[model samples]
Target: MTDKPSGKSFDKLTRRQTLAAMLAAGMVGTGMRSASAADFAAFNPGYAKNIVMPAFAQLAAASESLATAASAGCADPKAPDLITLQQAYHIAADAWADAQMFRLGPLADGQRAERFAYWPERRNIIDKQLSALLADDDTISLDAAKLGGSSVAVQGIPALERLLYRDEPLPPTGCAVIQAIAGNLVAIATEAQKAWQQAAAKPAPFAANPTEATTQFYTNLLTLLQIVADQKIGAPLGGDVAAAKPKSAEQWRSGRSLRNIRRNLAAAQNALFGKGGFAALLTPEQSALADNLKKAFADAIAAAEKAGDDLPADVSDESRRHLATELLVKVNHLRDLLRQDVPPVIGITLGFNELDGDGS
Candidate 1:
């Protein structure tokens, strides 16, 4: 007689069967007619007031603290000061990771997001620009205003990371560069926060049409998932065990690439399921899909956390690489659910080629 299926295999078959049944029951494309205009009205403003605004405010606060820590570390350069500065950097970076998801309104205006943290910097541009600036150390060029107008690569987190994460103590001029970059981060964060506050009052595009505004938020959510899977993890993981390129991982110098992914997934969960979030529009009939989406996010986040802090190392070591690989798979599954299940239920139609471009 043929052997019975193993427990894991049986579970997998059961899940596939359940999904197929749900799809056949019109769970995928049947838009929820019960979702009211009032639900849409509450979604945008509530997301802004509760989720987006608070994140930016935290970012502003963290940036200010980072600037202060940078100044203290520059003056003292003591071990304690350096530790404090690094801790501040971690907090500020985490805040930015959380706030970066909104990607709408003020954050999109004036190249603000790029100015704050330029990534996928495949050319080693930050180091090149920073090396040139440090070599010259021309007082005018080092000024925050001048640097702000310079190449975006040198103006943000990547540049600051290079300055702080070196073996040798920063030269006096290097300290000055750190201070300038910290000041620039503060300015960029504050400008974004102030603009968001103003926009919250009017909430122009968000308030204009609920469906369009929600589509924007949905697009941001899916795009971030793709970036995490493709660039953040996949780039370092490469094609196979022999092909791994650990240095390509984001924030590898400070070893927070996986931490960034965890935070991004957490923020995405909040954006979708928190009070007054997109989940508010879900009808009773759509509860199963909502639960599935939530579970997908949770699974992805758990995998990221399990992968640990040293993403570069995780991707490089053949034995440890599966953790990163598993995280990538979970992220892709989450992205697929959002793309296939969410748009139909929410009444937004995304083109097949909608998310193909460079969203960043």
Candidate 2:
């Protein structure tokens, strides 16, 4: 790595500060909104469905809504007014930031694997994509300029005013999205850690993995899947149709702009389960995970088509409940398979104590 600036004065800024600078300078990001519990439906295999998917659903709505509103106003997807777009971006960024902090731990002491790795590895993808959304005006539209100075608009939430991210007229809404996305990653890690704590009394077996990296990967992957599957809100079980297909003008406009998101989802999937030509990027056990997840994704889609989204607007609670139940069960089956694999892969094959000192 280019030798980091070494002079004491130059080095004083914390990693978060350094990260902020990178964020402003247009770093990249992982595709997709944030990593969540729903992500586990693929990793764990059978905890529950619809858990982590809700947040993603909310984010998807926010993204599509932003696009729809912009389209209605005759603004190109590329021309989203910074102020309005800023809201979506920051929410995304905040979510991302939360995840980063959670996985890496506190900003108090700079930690790379724990703190900054994901930014370089994932969030940067978002920055690069969102930054391209504007033109050379380089200055906010006159109306938006006025909006930025007004205290009432933000409800006086103190502007970040930090060096990397500024208040109003954002260069890349994706960077803001990064912050939001980070939050989710952290949440996923927190839940995994929590599950681990409870495993001992129940003879969970994950604590005995062969390697820290292996164990961690499995822990992070499975626990996240369980939580999201059970929740079933955003990115709802049996609901990837919205993402896989685009409907609105914005979707058509930014049709392929989301390639990174798709790519990362593939990467994350490979890291957890291993398929879609993602095998080379994972371990042997992870490859099996990819196979298991592939089965789950296929099963969820099958269940959805059978259940049908055509339920009457006023469909009875009983019918809707059944549909939801069947959908979640499909998702749960996937989670169960993955979860069953975690203990054996980690404890018997990898060994838990091995991880304590191995991870960077």
Candidate 3:
């Protein structure tokens, strides 16, 4: 899914368009500012040092690569499979780029440290990059295995594919998955914003470098998480799989459906955690995300049975499109709570953000 076409558009981006995108969004110099004080200060920094920044940077750089890759093949497709690969490449790269571009100033360098305008430019880059990456896919090989080994192995044909009709385009299951992550991101960000609001109620001095550092970190995390949420889920949820034009709506749907599970898996995201957390078979992949997700599928299924709904349909039905959109928002909330919960850099900067705790 990562190979790219080296075309005029892609070449143009490297030469002129990239600068244009950076400039148009004022990311080259002006525009975009940092977030407020409370946002970064709340998280543990010691753990975050090796956690957030580098990952954020890597995601940024990788996304850049992905965008370029996608630009090369965003448009044409000779086979149904190739279309799927193209879309997946575009979606994955799109997600990564979007996540890294959150509070882009941390990524950008300038006199005033602007982020707003920079991110908008970053947005344009994502769109253009997707287009450019897909401009000519003739060079791309749609050799089934190359597109990830029977993207529909047992495969392709399933309920998940239902969401990907011409009207739906992106497929229901995948869209649901995308929606779930995005919604959580927005919700989490809103929570951070609320925390910021509360900070206003108890406004503390952030003039101290430690406090400034804490504030900046918190804001960046909030912004970054939101970006991750939106890119991985929201954009894809609203995308047109038909643009890639998979062989059949069914094929498109199934691929997208499976992607719902894959995106979270790839991002090291989980869909089950907390109370009633199940003891289920852990695929080698699920091990990483298990702690972060709510094990609510069984519960939803049981509830669905009691309510006289079909099990799969019942479980897949979402009160909200975030995880529950893909899988229960409330349960998702529980999982989110469990998130302060996990990750490699979870406790790096212990108590660095305390009012008198001196971040260093």
Candidate 4:
């Protein structure tokens, strides 16, 4: 459930708003007088070239494959075609999980992210909307442009997941819906990739300015970590063992909830520690912090992998649930290091108000 909305006031904040808060808090600029523009000269371009662009490109390519598979599945409605469609879906979903961490630029434009994969749907909006769309006599839902303008719940991967991952064979209408969604996904991914390519070619203000870009990327990193620990893991875990709600987990119907978490963590780790990543910005004095951040991320990813492909049966199932708990702990620790420790070393000053609360 990437970027799921919650009732909490803080959780309601948009990604842009959250980034604004980080900036207002001085969580992204150089506070050290010794720090200079030259120190971070390569940061933004490196990320754009090596990380963001490639992820979006992969997303675009995977989505094209998914669209093709959906069309073939619609024609045949056969077991093998269905299996191939599912495989393509897995590839596209993995690409999304990798790309979603960099929730800036074109990905944030025009509700594109929500339209790609709406989840953590507490009210079962996807099911209800999809059912309504399927039952409609009109052909409006089959048109990609019109469908993109419809309820986002029925416009993305979740809706397609409901259609494809079911026990019964998809009816013709359902197959049409699948094709519509796959087409929409392709359009979104392609537009995003193109937009990113253009933005990378002519850097935006945030991308051109080292301080602003650093702030943007760091804010994205912290927010993703928080989301994984809170909404992704904590929601399903619930307050106690008996209260556990495994279905609350993201993409549970496809049995990839834990896999999504692992992929998200892996992507974030790469953005932060991969070649030309933030880890390179650290000086010799910050080596210990860099090493600790790397280890924390490694431990968190390991715990997520250990949790298996899906969430545990219940929070009381210590053998598996404990791994989820361990993951939450490790992720929180990693976020804390980045939030509380890294800023000072990297020359960013955390504002008093921002430090007063978790900032969600």
State every prediction's TM-score relative to the real structure. 0.85, 0.33, 0.30, 0.88
Of candidates 3 and 2, the better by lDDT: 2
TM-score, candidate 2, is: 0.33
Estimate, for each residue in 44-130, the C-alpha lDDT of model 4 and write its tens digit: 677778878889999999999998898786675334377878898999999999988776667666668778987657477688778
Instruction: Please report the TM-score between candidate 4 and the true structure.
Output: 0.88
Candidate 2 per-residue lDDT, tens place, 130-169, comes to 3432232432332322322322211111112121234444
Candidate 4 Cα misplacement greater than 4 A, ranges: 1-12, 15-33, 77-80, 201-208, 312-319, 349-360
Q: Highest lDDT: which candidate?
A: 1
Deviation in Å, model 1, residue 260 alpha carbon: 0.5
- Candidate 1 vs candidate 3, TM-score winner: 1
| Candidates sorted by TM-score, best first | 4, 1, 2, 3
- What is candidate 3's lDDT per residue for 126-146, written digit by digit as tens? 234323323435313322123
Candidate 1 positional error at 97, Å: 0.8
Measured over all alpha carbons after superposition, the RMSD of each candidate to the real structure, in angstroms, is: 11.8, 17.6, 17.6, 3.9
Question: By summed lDDT, which 10 consecutive residues of candidate 2 come out lowest?
Answer: 152-161
lDDT of each: 0.74, 0.33, 0.29, 0.74
State the lDDT of candidate 1 residue by residue for 1-360, as single tens digits: 211113343345345433432332212234445444455555777777887889999999999999999878777533436677788888989998998887766666655676788787745767877787777747423667777777777778877888778887665568767778789889999998887787664423432455556556666677688778888999899988789998888888898898899999999999888876778777778999988998998899889889989988888888998899899999999989988877767766543222254332
| Angstrom error at residue 145, model 2 | 22
For model 3, give the 10-residue run with minimal summed lDDT: 111-120
